[model samples]
Target: MLKSNFARFAAVGLAAAALVSLGATAANAAPVPTEGPLYVYDGNGILIPTAGHVFDWNDNISASLSATDMAAPFHCSADATDSYTFLAPQGQELTRSAWQAYAPNGFTAEGSKDLLAFTLSPYQQTNGTQGVAKVNGGKWSLGLACTKDNGVNYASSGVWWLPVTVEAGTGKFTADPVGDPVVGSPATIDLEATTVPVAPDVDGPLSLNVPVGAKATLGAAALVNGLSTSTGKLGEFTVTDERALSKKGWTLTSSVADFVNGTNTIDKKQLGIKPIVVSGTAVAAAAQVAGSATGSAPFAELAPLAAVGTTKLNADLTFVAPKDSVVGTYTSKLTLTLASK
Candidate 1:
């Protein structure tokens, strides 16, 4: 009986050992260790996420300065402030000192072709989004110089307007991966919603000097031909809107009161002087030039909004002085005003 009991006990112990070996094998056969989000490297790269995923850096930000800011002849500065709420998931630990910088490829003057850059600091965050990262100090300050040609001041030089945009490829951002392998679209710098100020400029002065001895009914071509003799060539007044369609359209208002010499004034009707816009065989009324633009008459519209070059318009006065008028130096202010429409 004792021998039989020992055999049963040994057999039970052997079965228990076999079960333990099977459990070990099963544990070893399990799948290999998989990395978790804690140490993940997403292929999409890092994201400077804005509200609702709308990357409208241009639309969300605005740059403004007093006309006085750009009124100086040599240099001037204006303050520009913009606020946008952004969320940086992978950048939770990022501090205000850990700022990001971008090199805008086309934010340069049109003539000098000088490029510009700006920096953004993380100031506030909500949930995962920051509140306000003021681009203050001197970063938002603009250094501009007044340009003049032949006693005429130029407001814009093409380099300051037309808002150069960037999206994914036009610009880049700085980054640092502290913990896990963080990735982002650092190249995706959107400018579709942003717009910069443009200084519209008009060049060429219209000066007509015809003696009373000259014949009546002076056509545009004749006036230009005669004036060309003294003022090189009678060129059209070139209108340039570097801001283009980024803002509202502009207008060219030409109005003349009457010829005046000291206290003497030439009656408007007697002068018979009207600015006429003649293109080929199409002749339009005075005040209105180029095409029959929308809004009001006599206002030229800025079409082909994407165009960067200048548009030229030829204007001349139809002199019909009375044959019996008194002889004296008659002068009138041919007022040409350019304003945003």
Candidate 2:
């Protein structure tokens, strides 16, 4: 019985060993790969590169006209033939005739194709004060159709930037002094003149019987931003003592306590109420009465800096009549010039 048991154990051991050997052989076996051959062409579509990248069309083209193709710049005829060359790779299995065969599917603008063309229309474009000529027509895309070794049809395409220009429109150049309150489209400020009556009675030792005074106000600068330059300036206020009855003397001054930019409020003690000494004049030869005072004052400095809005300047003129002097009409010309800096 013991012998019979040993034989049965040995047979079981052999069966187990066979199963382990089979598993080992399976793990050691090499895997087989399945892959197809890769085929490539000389070029995506057209083998030769086109000449000329950017084209600048001259005045010959008109904005009013529209057509399938343009002349000269593009080098392509209006008929679309002979303008561009269409050639296939030589000595290759694929010929221009077999081009469609490779691509069983048809060619489309977006799809694979043997040939393609695109165009853009002319439109208006503006850059600041500058005007750009109508773009007219531009080629957006150019592509050629080709066939692969397989049954699939493909297209090699390219995009180009074709900028054509026409005669540029003219631009305007202007310089103006705009006040806090804008007057016109380009902007204007008013520096009006007014006359003030003085008390006849003398107040103190240095006082006189009466004095006829004229007031001139300064407006905002259109182009002058409180800076002085050749093209423009902040502003200037000139007074020409054209004809004054009194020969004794006259005084010119400002009401601005502190000439500052961007100040909204006109200070009672500063703006229209301050005292400024006015001296200097380019008196006219004919109007130069003996012992008469005439001069031009520049208000450009009173203009605020970098202030894009309006500003104000008040100029006061006083005529110091000689005691017991002639009493005729006293007149003067007040000129205010607001310039750009």
Candidate 3:
């Protein structure tokens, strides 16, 4: 019995060992084949998530897609052929008129290809004082066609609003006379006009000169022996006394004639000598009368009373005295007057 029991025990131990070995082999064996069938396809039609194809967080798109051809907006251009205007007084010329171009945005500008081709119109509406006209401030506009390299050609039109101003030439007028007394005298008056481009806030004054005791002739110069000259004899004599006159807000300055000394003589034959003809009758005072003395007198009174037999006659007389009398005493007064012209 003991032997049979020991043999059964060994058999049981062998069975248990076999079971442990089987469990170990099963744990180490290869996994069973997957149930799905294998196949291949081009990645072209595959659907992709939008997030997968995004360039960045801001721009999301499918990774498998692309945008079609796109284009920019079309451009247009326009311009004014002429831009500047010039004005001038009648019988004047313009010095300069230039035009320039500018771009405010994406457009580009270049110098005109044909500068000489620009045209200018003749001056119109010419009055006695002013003239008006138009001139071509040369400029051009280019079209929106693509550049030679197939890039968008950014061309723009430009305009120039040039400032126009009037240019006047020198002008002239006749001169008018200014001051004097009434005497046969010579004087010069100046003729002038405001120069072109007159300075700011300045007005020019015209002036003239006349003899101390003479009047000026207006319009035309005085004629001497049919020849025109500034000097002319007065219609009446000027008073020996100084005088003044005013006209047109101007003063006529004048001077009186000066008298110094005198002598007297008488002889019908001696006074009537050739080139020395004695003026008819004279009084003792006649020889002494000098400044602006008018009228005639007989010589008999001018001669001193003669002795009953002696023919020689002599006379003492008082002469009109000059204000400042001396060796070279010459006294005169200046008067100021105005012009009417």
For candidate 3, write residues 1-341 as lDDT tens digits. Answer: 11110000000000111101111221111111111111111133332221112111111111111112111122223321222222222111111111111111222234321111111111211211122122231111111111111111211221111112212221111111112211322334566787532334442332333334554221333343443322212222111111112112211222223322233221111111001112322212233233323312231221222111111122222223233333332222223232222
lDDT of each: 0.27, 0.22, 0.20
Better of 2 and 3 by TM-score: 2
Using lDDT as the measure, the top candidate is 1
lDDT of 1 by residue, 1-341 (tens): 11110000000000111101111221111111111111111122222322122222222221111111221121211211111112222221111112222111222343432222212222222222222222221111111112222101211221121011122432212222212221331233234576643444532222222233432323332223322111111124545555533534455554555656677764544332233333322223344221122213352444333344344555444443444445555654444566654
Taking the candidates one at a time, how many backbone clashes does each contain? 16, 20, 17
Alpha-carbon TM-score of each model against the true structure: 0.25, 0.16, 0.14
Which regions in candidate 1 have their CA more than 4 angstroms from the true location? 1-235, 245-247, 269-299, 303-308
| Ten contiguous residues with the weakest lDDT in model 1 | 5-14
Stretches > 4 Å off in candidate 2: 1-294, 300-305
Tens-digit per-residue lDDT, 209-296, candidate 2: 1124544433332222332111111132343321222212223322122222343322122111122224333211222111233333
Q: After superposition, how far is residue 244 of candidate 3 from its true place, in Å?
A: 23
Model 2 worst lDDT run, 10 consecutive residues = 5-14
